[model samples]
Target: MSRTPEAPSAPPVDGARTTDSTGPDLAAPARRSRLVAVDAARGLALIGMIAVHILPVYDPETFEPTLQWTLFGGRAAALFALLAGLSLAFSSGGRTPHRGRALTATRAGLVVRALLIASAGLAINQVMPSPAPALGILVYYGAFFLLAVPLLGLRRRTLAGGVVVFAVLGPVLVHVLGPVLPEAAAVNPTVGSVLADPGAALAQVLLTGTYPAVPYLSYLCAGLVLGRTDLHDVAVRVRITLVGTVLALGAWFAYWVLVLQAGGYAQLTQHTPWLSEDQINEILVWGPSRDLPTSTWWWLLTSGPHSNTPVTLIMDLGTGLAVLGLFLLVARPNWLWTTLGAMGGRTLTLYSAHLLALAMTVHYDRPALWFAVHVAVAAAFAVLWQRWCGQGPLERGITAAVRGTRRLVLGAPSRTAASPRS
Candidate 1:
């Protein structure tokens, strides 16, 4: 879910030092130069995700969507995935993608990292089981990383093209393939289930289940494009902000015009005769059930949270870019932002811990108190650990593994490689 920083001079992918050692010097002060904005954005995403997991999604009496659901429901995961792409880009080569053996080694390292994260997720699924407190994102992350391995060397323009392609086609694939494929058996898939019916598991992670990887490729490619840019430039940051705002507003406006002003809503109700008007409205507000009813193409026009349609993907992508751009504009050495940055830098540890804790407890009885406790403990732990140690425990272990894989594949570097600026 996250990695630690390296010196701004030359950060490697996954925070692996490509110098005489395989890790960073925890005592070094230069680590501050790593992008605080990126980390802060990641921290905010973590907070949003935690809130979504703990808070009530709808008001019991009003039957209206809760503020947390409105704000963070689908967007937090989008932001996290987008950041993951940025991390991949930063690690692989940033503005200049790696080639030859370097690229090969980078891909190898990524594969190892993906497997580790996915393995952890599968193991976690064993304990949490179906109807778990949270549908963990780690396993799907592995798929994302592996899918990205092939695209690591693409230029910024090409990656931007990739974003467009995936945004349109990925969801289309899901809509077409979802009904025919076997339905997913578990909400949180375990190793046993995956092994027993790999096809169904694959279908679930790729297209049917929550946070399907195929449609989500848009976010990853968008992040790749962002990472390939001069993020330090004020003009670039401003463009990101403007572009994001326009894209988000434009997508929403289009959805409204087509679905509401036009006949798209009428078509949805007509096609799904079993669902009442209230159920249709619920789908519009809270997202679809299992998968959006494929009875009508009109469903694609809706842009609700987790809808996984082109409209929803584009809107969420825009929202993610806006958040990242704003943070880039405002990030500083101040306490508030830096505290967030610290937490963001160790989300791999923090997020996993949160999931495990949720699995062990019944927080629904006192959701607000549990949410507060989760946030407080995560923030305090992150700040203190970041001050005392360089990388998170899980991040450190992953970094070491990735570095070893790189070393095995490419041998030692002749000179010290610079850290990436992610």
Candidate 2:
């Protein structure tokens, strides 16, 4: 089954002042508005992920990819990852990176957050083991957070460079190392599996798993660059939208030229004799089988969803950026966007609940009905909770824990506030 990206942190509060003890307050009025837009975009990502999880990807009769499959697929996960990076950037110091003791505290807090999220994922994995209905992304998200720690201090240009390097090299590394590494013990690895063979578990999360952190760094770095920009400017938002559209189209064009136009598909058939032409096509439409066949280098040129090829990475990144830019452009202080922002703010809690609900319920029988039910319930809960309570229940707890960690590290009253819509 295809996997969707899980939510990360809660959206940061608006107009919260950051002191020296905390970080600098990056959320001015315009910045606050930008964050609300970010929340709306994240809300869309959350809804898209739910649709992917619940709805059919392929039409049963035709075996053709469904509309939901085409729209969500890997793109929703990419958006989640990009937003995660943006969240980190905002929390640390939007536009200006945190330094000294503040930086240390922020990193420490992030580590704590990573561990908590991973632990939750591990516990969930025990219930939803291999061949589970939905694969939990929380564990891999932990690794993503940990990997991002070192790069948090970097500026936009350097991070942008990192995006290119990771996009190109991550897949190459996977191709080289995938053949030698032991196959992952389970699709959704548990704590027991990790304890049994740490190396295999590490290998899976880093390289061989469905959502490997190495290749995903491209999305994170791209988001970091976006976070550093002056997002309040209309010119900046327009440029982002234009550049993102061009990048997405360009990547798709390159893939078409390289794979279909060139002899890349033929090369694939020649190399992987086990898979028939139809089977290969299925893999293209439905994503990889077990893992992408490393039988030929030509596989790198194909840009299927979750293929993690350079082209796929670039394309997904562009799409994610474009979505964010458009949301930012259209953001207004209105009821609709505010409600969406509220839902976005509670994603961590909501996504976790969603996974649990999937585990307990039989959603496949009537996926459309179930999808609607889940969205409506989640929306209602988010709206009510935002009205009654400021932060989400789980988000509030995580924030408290993160704040405590920061205080422990700084050995003082830590004033570093959470980033808006982070």
Candidate 3:
């Protein structure tokens, strides 16, 4: 929103944000079909992810709470997935494309893009050691985009119904099909290293067993459905976010409680009623399966099983909604949305920056202080982007690459640089 650019786009790895519980009010996703809250969540998520990734850059051995592999670790990416879903639905041309036309063409284009992005993720992980990202969000997101188009045409109620049914039966679907999926195994680096060939990361991305595949698509589809809601008004957006924030968090806590309290309440009941009563809870219990018939808890927590998964549904979804509340509380201040929103807008660029930062991390011999500094720095860069340039550099690049070609066909001039004083 600021017409004037602030400073350079790089963060000093040595800088640190005191984790002030009191940052400015932020934007909510529902407000922007672009899903402002979702973007804010992603911006925050990626920042946290970068911090954790760089934490190794700062401190190679001692992991920070932000980087911990518990329920917390998984939260950021889930937010990314859900927002991807929302973006897919939001970006759809209001109506689903008929059997032909650009929609058909877009589908083909998306597949290619997905592979392209997945390849990039693989290359980054293969090169970097500590933050070796096995299950990249873009790979799964591409798969989700393919599924989302058709669902957009489904009646809203049908969409909602399907989401619930699939979620309920998620455990069963995974049980039968998960073994073949790559991401499931990639869920943990321990298993991922066996199959991961950074050189062949793209192939692994396509593997049925890869992370961000089936069950992950479910989250994207759900987001697409949510995006269908015409909550454009600030008031309506606030109300929906307020309600969703409550439900998502409530469900998350409830899931945690059920898992913990099941000690006496018909052990393995979460699985018994679904996966098979005879299925032993331990192996059956295997990490929090966000798959079919695994457990209701999966939907609340993540689209995947928990393996020291840091980011939980509560954090991803909650932070998104709460950030929105903060924005509304501040009467939708421009800077509030633009800053966090900048990361979302420049997702691919920032994503690449993150990888580049990680490469720097590995190259720097895993310094903890530098990593934290970058986390803060990445965010500061985002603010700079919003103020200096309106659209994200990465988003701009991808849009140009994808749309520029089309524009050339129409005899339109190609636009490369974004406005500095955007």
Candidate 4:
């Protein structure tokens, strides 16, 4: 979600570094360096998302999901959400965090940015001509930002604790509350839906929609916690890698024990006699048949991708963290890593462009080729743009708008603070 560091930096609190805003500081050095590991992780996520959009999930010959789908799928989006939270932390004052007037300014900036993202998402949904709609994440991103506003001020420990609470409680809450909520149309929501059926749209975004904010907030909070940590430290990265892997693998093992081998599937079969093994495999690999199955509580047991169930949430969050840690571990001074990190830096531009490309009819004919083309174009453009322009077009535009808005909202006095608006 964050293009570049704009938030004011401060000393670390208990070894955790403080964060900065997304907009650039005019007085700051022109050749600003970014956190390579984080950017590389983000780049990896963006590519995975592109694969999800462009490549076939299932192989034509085998009717089984390709490695791309199995590897990326929900994990990519989870990484994106996690990175968004990290960006939020940076924007809010990093480890130290902002207080009083600075806090107010951060909140205002986030709100405005959320509005812009949501608006763009709606507009894209309306205009993009995909034969089958793409599940636009921009709207969900906007909601996540809005939801994160209130949680921005907390310390590292508190935020980490929140991750635990959200991981367990958020899914339970969704399971209990989601069914009663009004279901919106299955199609991607447009701006027209906001005007014509505001309630349904709101409900969908908050509860039932793809990438619903309620459950996905767990990833965001986890990333926020990670952001507060001393990401630059090798020990920290190692610890994160170990812990995240354990959590991820542990979740999978739990699911295997409780669902696959524990008669949960049998319970479902007893209830829905028409269910097939292929369908079950699809749920296992792709996600749940729907968001979840209401017929049996056993659905809550599996850690399938995008199930939005407790087990799956934990698994995805762990996998995301593990992937992030691995990226950080491998992120070093190299041409490949540098290029990938550059690509990650311009995610706003590349992601939006990728979506637009998907809407085009020509690209649909040969998705693998199109996927490769988009990646090359995005990577090349990112490297060149980072060298020449210093920021992607959309990144620059949004940061400028946010800076202007922050300045207006906070007035002249706030601008003179230790951290001036970029």
Tell me how candidate 2 scores on lDDT: 0.85
Question: Could you tell me every candidate's TM-score relative to the true structure?
Answer: 0.91, 0.93, 0.63, 0.88
- In order, candidate lDDTs are 0.81, 0.85, 0.46, 0.74
What candidate 3 gets wrong by more than 4 Å, as runs, is 1-38, 54-72, 94-102, 130-135, 180-210, 264-331, 360-368, 385-390, 404-422
lDDT of 3 by residue, 1-422 (tens): 00000101111011112334676323233234334545665666666555434333112254222233332344555556656655655454432422334455445444544555555554555555553432344544455555555665565577666655544444345454444544433432222453554423332333233343444544555565656664445675677568657755675565566544534235446434654543334222233333333343333333223321112333344544444444434433356656675665666776666665645434355455665666566668777877788666655555555454433434443364433445
Which is the winner by lDDT between candidate 1 and candidate 4?
A: 1
The prediction achieving the highest TM-score against the true structure is 2
Question: What's the residue-level lDDT of 60 in candidate 3?
Answer: 28
Sort the candidates on lDDT, descending order: 2, 1, 4, 3
* Strongest candidate by lDDT: 2
Span of ten consecutive residues with least summed lDDT in model 1: 1-10
Clashing pairs in 2: 12-421, 22-415, 22-416
Measured over all alpha carbons after superposition, the RMSD of each candidate to the real structure, in angstroms, is: 6.0, 4.8, 11.1, 5.9
Residue 289 of model 1 has an lDDT of 53
Better of 1 and 2 by lDDT: 2
Better by lDDT, candidate 3 or 2: 2
CA deviation > 4 Å runs, candidate 4: 1-34, 130-133, 414-422
Model 4 per-residue lDDT tens digits across residues 1-422: 00111111111122232336875443222112226767778888888887777778878898887888788878887888888888887777766778988888888988988888787788777876634336778877788889988988887788787787777777776678778877776456778777888898898887777677877788878877886776666788889888889988998999888878888778867765666877766777777644665666777776667777778778877888898888777777478877877888788778777777767766667888988998899999989998998877877777777788888877886446868768
lDDT of candidate 1 over 1-422, digit per residue (tens)? 11111111113333333344666564222224336888888899888988888988899999999998888878888888888888888888777778999999999999999899888888877888346778788888888888888889888888899899999998888888888999767876689889889999999888887778888888989988987886756788899988988989999999999999988899999998999999889888888755788888888888878888999999988998999899888788689988888888888889888888988867989999999999999999989998999788888998889999999999865644645445
Arrange candidates by TM-score, descending. Answer: 2, 1, 4, 3
